[model samples]
Target: MQDILGHLQRLGMSGYEAKAYVALVAAGRPVNGYEVAKRSGVPRSTVYETLGKLVARGAAFEVRGAADATDYRPLPPEALLDRMRREFDGSVDALRDALPAVAGAPEGHLIHNLKDGGALLDRAEDVVAGARRGLVLSVWPQEMARLDGPVRAAAGRGAEVSVMAFGDLGDLGGPRGGERIYEHRYSAPEAVLADLGYRLLVVVGDRREAVVGGFGGDGSAWGIYTADPAVALMAAEYVRQDIALQILAERVGGDELNRLFATDPGLLRLLGRR
Candidate 1:
């Protein structure tokens, strides 16, 4: 009963309305205001008023009988939920059509924090979907699975899509035609997994916006999303440098590349391993 009330409340019902509706539905037959007050523990003084509001909201119907008697019946739960879904969808569509015309003001630079893995993934997908010219990303296999559709969709729409993947992407599947995929070779996937306890993901869209984050195996994740040009450019450059390093590594071979980094004092100091 409490669960039902909670759900009803979420659906925009007030406490008295939810309680009164629950009582009516439990009765499964026509119930007068007095019976609803007694069964739902709603105060007798306000039970009629609550039922009237429920009727106005289409959550209940009032049955008319002889002698001015009115008994109320709740709308079936399944029917009520279906109607709510339809109404919500209609409202969303209406707002989608109406909002853009009213919202003509330019948006300033903004940063948002996404504190869950699902939200991070959602923002990444949105960035990919909105890419007009190019998309660059750094991702691991696990998240790549979730983002494959939007990435492919962006590429299909003529955006240049480039990926710098952290782990083995042998079966990583989505890229086609002009898309570029580079594997990062600085550390083994196992070493990264052990060291970070999480996988880092970054996406930059059309050089305009970016999302950067880490998803942990322990079910905690966090990300920052921003449309600030400087931040977005920094993220884009970070991925660009990773791609450049991969190309250099291919030319010099991984062993020779590591040998140079180890030998060069400046490089060693930059890497903080001196």
Candidate 2:
């Protein structure tokens, strides 16, 4: 069965090891090296060397030995497979133990990779789907429209939902309307909105956070995620400041909103502008 022996060789067996095993199977007994080489078409010297390797590898072993004479046989297929599996599992365990060091090396780093719009949307959806506690989205009208259902579902599952969003999110089946929605409206003066619009959607979780910036423009968008406490705290503070400004804008009326918020100091500081 040269074909079968070749197949075994390809499956990580040494060439002579495969030949020796095949010869043992065909002979149906512990065979000597000369007969193994002759029948399996391996050279005599190579047969003995391969047999030694097989014995060390636990695939085949010598049952008896004398000067220039050794009776060798293959392990049962099941036993061979079991040992192979154990070897593979041991290798995997060793690699897993070394993972932190491997990942920690700075020789080559994986910098930020950009995905197309559709893929980026899928990433955002993944964050929304995994959200456990709540979602705080600072969104433009178009992006807000896309997220309405996800936010509703989050609220349905008892999430504390909040949106300080641009444009009217119009009665997105608010919690009172047989749906779960907690919403807050925030808009700058027309002149301010005309100049700079809210273009971000942020999803905040207890330990995970995803922020999408530059929503609904000429496709200038980027986002970041981090589990670091310091990073999350900074993000939360930025959202808080933006929401506070929006609340004050809504209360003060258009002219007053313009007069007070149009100033670079009030708007810039509140919106986390640097």
Candidate 3:
């Protein structure tokens, strides 16, 4: 019962209105305000107003009763659901048509934070889907699983897609023609994440948009999606640099570079050392 009320609230009903409508639905016949209050646990003082709101919203119909009293009958559940679906779809359709016309050039502060892991994933998906020409992505294995479908679809449509993946991919699949995947030198994602203090995510699309984020072990995540061209280019370059480093390390050898970094004063300072 509570779950049903929650659904109604999400669809734009106040708690009183949801309760009143549910009461009318369960009543089987038209129910007066007094009976609605009793059944729904709403106070009698506000029950009539709540019922009136339901009637106004077409969720309930007012029925004339004996001795100048009025009763309410709920719209059938099937009809209510149909109405809600139509309204929701229509609003979405209208927004799709209207928004792009009004959305002109990039405005101030084009960067926006995605507040959590779910939002982070959503923005990443949006960036991938919006890529027309080409995209460069560097991501960890766990998130790559969730994003591979869209990535493959984008590549299948002939958009150039390059992926620099951290950790074991284990036969990562994509459209055969335009997609390429590079494995990071650090085979385990945890090694890279531990060195960086958090898991890093970077997605740059068509050299125009970018998303950068960090994920933590406690299910907390933070990210930003940016439309600034300079920022986007910088992000793309970051991943490209990583790819370059990976290639160099693979071919040129890691041991000598490790020795250089450990012994060279300039390189040590560059690594944030004393």
Candidate 4:
């Protein structure tokens, strides 16, 4: 009884109206104001007014009663529910059509924050999937596993795809069949992650949009996505520099790279590894 009253109130009924309507429904017949007040525990003072509101809302119907006293009967539950559903859907459709014109155009560069791993990845996947001209990405192996499909799809559609990947992503079968893939060799991915306190993931699409995210060791994640040209270009350059670093590492060799990492404090600060 309490549950039914609560549900009715949520559907836009006042407390008295909900109780009175429930009383009418439970009575399963036309009931007078006095009887409704008694069954529903609504104050007799407001019961008639409440019943009138229900009648106005079509949740109840007024009927003639003995001695000209008015009585009310509940609309059948199925009919009442179906009517409400249709009304609600109609309102939603109208808003969907009308609200956008009122919202107007984009004011400026847009940046949005994604507060969890799922949302961050979802936005990254959207950026990758929507890329038309090119893609630049820097991904930890963990995130790359999730993004592999979108990356391949983008590349297969003729988008120039470049990936600067940390950690060995075994089974991707080297070179990813054609996309520019740069495997970082300066330090272990774990060491870099430990120094930074999170796994960083970046995706830049068409040099026009980017998603930069941090997936942390403590199960927390956060990220930002933007169409801001400056930010996107910066992220793209970050990946490009990484690809260039990989090329330099190959030419300089691991021994020389390790010597620089150990000897140069500035290099340690920049690389976030030692």
Number of the predicted model whose lDDT against the real structure is largest:
1
Q: Residue 68 deviation, candidate 4, in Å?
A: 48
lDDT string, candidate 3, 1-274, tens digits:
9999999999989999999999999999998999999999989999998988888888999888778788789999999989999999999899999999998776574888899999999999999998989989999888888788888888988789988988767646533468888888833566777777788999999999999998897888999999988999999999998888778778868877677778999989988887
Per-residue lDDT, model 2, residue 255, is 68
lDDT, model 1: 0.90
Q: Model 2: clashing residue pairs? A: none
lDDT of 1 by residue, 98-131 (tens): 9998986776788999989999999999999999
lDDT of 2: 0.65
List, residue by residue over 187-232, the lDDT tens digit for candidate 4: 6787888889998999999999999999999999999999999999
**Location of the lowest summed lDDT over 10 successive residues in candidate 4:** 169-178
Of candidates 4 and 3, the better by lDDT: 4
lDDT for every model?
Answer: 0.90, 0.65, 0.87, 0.89
> TM-scores of the models, in the given order?
0.63, 0.46, 0.63, 0.58
Q: With candidate 1 superimposed using the best TM-score fit, by how many Å does residue 202's alpha carbon deviate from the native?
A: 0.2
Per-candidate Cα RMSD to the true structure, in Å, reads 5.8, 13.0, 5.8, 9.5
Clashes of 4: 0
Off by over 4 Å in 4: 1-105, 173-175, 258-274
lDDT of candidate 2 over 7-41, digit per residue (tens): 78866897777878777778888888888899888
Model 1 residue runs over 4 Å out of place are 1-101, 104-108
